[model samples]
Target chain A: EDQVTQSPEALRLQEGESSSLNCSYTVSGLRGLFWYRQDPGKGPEFLFTLYSAGEEKEKERLKATLTKKESFLHITAPKPEDSATYLCAVQAPKDSNYQLIWGAGTKLIIKP
Target chain B: SAVISQKPSRDICQRGTSLTIQCQVDSQVTMMFWYRQQPGQSLTLIATANQGSEATYESGFVIDKFPISRPNLTFSTLTVSNMSPEDSSIYLCSVKVQLSTDTQYFGPGTRLTVL
Candidate 1:
């Protein structure tokens, strides 16, 4: 089974604090890694997609990096508006279809 | 990026009643997906809606209870049949901009609260 595990279930940081959220996965064949930001009672918003190891993508204050077995979402100088649950998902290879396996996600609370 | 919108942003329904959520995409998409998320939980894909064919459901989800309809490439609807308190969740619609990649854009979501 394809599985994804995110570390630090919940995080509390002050404004301008820098932190990183981790997502590790195990799958038969990895196709891609995705990052999303979700607010309370709202749907997830797409952030970035990392394909291969050593690949990185950035958006504003958020940067996503992928490795062979894991991925990281780094937030630099976060603000209260950036407080949201960060989700990481992995797309696994199938015979002819692909399904995404999601992690529980890390809840980030940025206190201003 | 695609702009997706869902109707009835939030609703309170009684048990045994069913609710149908509609998803509209600004641009035509090849693949449209439906997902459910319980409070404080990760998103679970329910099915994939194809324009001309039947919707493909995932494990633990059936068409009878969660019937889906995709009339066209830019529109779809998911109906939660025989609703219960356990069915209270946020239903989301997503679409893949590129078929080869797994990058999916999501709608604002409909928050259903069964009482």
Candidate 2:
């Protein structure tokens, strides 16, 4: 079965602190890995999509990198406004439609 | 990037009542999906709203309970039927515009509270 697991269910970081959240997965024929940011009372916002190992994408202070069996979302000098739940989803090989296996998400708190 | 919107941002309903959530997209998307997020839980996909066809439901979700409608490419609806307290959740609508292979843009979810 295809599954995604995100570690460190919750993290508390001081302002300007940098850390990396992990998303490990086990799938048969990985198609793509996605990262999303969800604020309270709001749906998830798209962050990055990593298709292959050694691939990376960055947006502002958020950086996403992909490996064969895992992905990492690295936050650089995160601000309080950057605090949100980071979600990880994996798309495995499917014959008909695109289905995503998601992680529970990492709740990040940036204390000023 | 695509813009998606959902109606009735938040609502409180009595048990046994039903609620329907609407999702509209600025542009036509190939795939639209409905998801549910229980309090403090992750998003669980309920169904895939396929245009001009029957919506495909995921396991543990029934068409009789979470019926979906995709009359066109730019709009869809999801109805939560025979609601119970356990059915209270944030219902989200998402769209994939084929910008690439992945990446689903989501709308501000509808917060449902059942009493």
lDDT accuracy of residue A59 in candidate 2? 97
Worst 10 residues of 2 chain A by lDDT: A91-100
Considering the two chains of model 1, state its CAPRI-style docking category. high
Per-model TM-score of chain B: 0.97, 0.96
- For residues A1-112, write the lDDT of model 1, one tens digit per residue: 7899998999999999999999999999988899999988788999998989999999999999999999999999999999999999999976698889999999999999
Model 2, docking class: high
lDDT by residue for model 2 over A63-98, one digit each (tens)? Answer: 999999999999999999999999999998766656
Best of the candidates, DockQ: 2
Cα lDDT tens digits for candidate 2, B11-100: 999999999999999999988999999988899999888798899888899999998989999999999999999998999999888946
Name the runs in model 2 displaced over 4 angstroms.
none
Off by over 4 Å in 1: none
TM-score of 2: 0.97
